[model samples]
Target: MAHVTFKENRITLIGNEVKTGNKAPDFTLLANDLSEVTLADTTGKVRIISVVPSIDTGVCDAQTRRFNEEAAKLENVDVLTVSADLPFAQSRWCAAAGLENIKTLSDHRDFSFAQNYGVGIEELRLLARSVFVLDSKDNVTYVEYVSEATNHPNYDAAIEAAKAAN
Candidate 1:
């Protein structure tokens, strides 16, 4: 498990941490439209899964927006922001922020994505900050479990990994 801290205090992450070269775990999350979205649905494209506690927060907002912009330029890459926020809230935030390139998915219903990816923060019922890149064949090409929950991740490294996978 990844040792995680939120606001400087330690928190327990629910699942085993995934690493590069591992088979990416499959999960069912809710899309903005409330439809079930599975990893299998994204089979043929390189995926960048951005995990955050909540989309309404400063760091999460900025992170999603940054990926949205990057997604516009990455060929054959799908950037998906996963959070514990409700699907309605996720949709609202994306609309208000004018973010279209990156698809925001909600793990609020079952915490499946959070638990499977080992990013769920048990103390807060939110996801720990992390980033994952998966190639077309669903192998994890890169993984970043950000040490601090409130801090930003290594955006450049994640992007580079996605580009390489694509």
Candidate 2:
């Protein structure tokens, strides 16, 4: 279990902690393109799983754009922005932002992805803001569950970790 604070109140997450060097949990999520994408689909590529509470927020939007720009320069690396938003909404945001490199995925259909990755916000109908980096073989290289849900993640460190893993 992990404790996360949102709006100055601490909330406990009732799930397992995914640590570095551990095999990443596999999940099926709906891509903005309306296609099913799984962890297996990203095999042989370094992955950045960007879990956000909602893409409507400023922090989440900024993070997605940042990753999209960074992804353009990286080879064999995929940046996946995951949220509970619907596929249509995610597609609309990416389209408006002109985001082509970063893939936006939705977990609205079910909480399988969030639950398996231990990122679900138990009290709220959203996923806890977090980031996870995985190697080509699906080994977790770095994982960060932002203690403060409203704050943006350490993108520099997460990007550096992903590059190092590659």
Candidate 3:
């Protein structure tokens, strides 16, 4: 199990842990269109999974916007922002934020995605903040498990790694 602490003290997350070089666990997440999207659907394309606690928060919103902007310039790459929020809410947020490039996925129906990714917070209704970049073959190339939930990830480095993998 993976253990992550929020704000280095606020909350603790315990769940399965994913690592670089490992085959990424496949999951079925709900798309904004209410369609089921699995990792298989993204095969043959570079993918960036931005796992956030919630899109309603400042950090999550910022990350989504940043990725949405950056993703527009990337070819053959699909950026997915995942959270436990409902698909309806996610769709509303995306429209309101003008997040057109990045795809927002929801894990509210079940914890299958969270469990498979090992990002589920055991004691709370939250997911550990993380970023995973996968190659076309579904092999993890870069992974960052934020030690402190409140802090943003190293996006520049993660994006660079994703580009390099492509």
Ranking by TM-score: 1, 2, 3
Pick the winner on TM-score between candidates 2 and 3. 2
Compared with the true structure, all predictions reach lDDT values of 0.93, 0.88, 0.86
Residue pairs of candidate 3 with colliding backbone atoms: none
Model 2 C-alpha lDDT per residue in residues 1-166, reported as the tens digit of each score:
6678887688766457798889998888998778898889988999999998899889899888888899998887899999989999999988888889988999988777887888887788788889999999999999999999999889998999899999
lDDT of 3 by residue, 48-92 (tens): 899999999999998889888889988888899999999998999
Can you give the TM-score per candidate against the true fold? 0.98, 0.95, 0.94
- What tens digits encode model 1's per-residue C-alpha lDDT throughout 65-162? 89999999999999999999999999999889998898889999999988789988888889999999999999999999999999999999999999
Model 3, C-alpha of 113: deviation from truth (Å): 1.7
Clashing pairs counted in every model: 0, 0, 0
Model 2 segments beyond 4 Å from truth? none
Mark the regions of model 1 whose C-alpha exceeds 4 Å error after superposition.
Answer: none
User: Which candidate number would show the highest TM-score if scored against the true structure?
Assistant: 1
What would you estimate as the lDDT of candidate 2?
0.88
Error of 3 at 119 (Å): 0.7
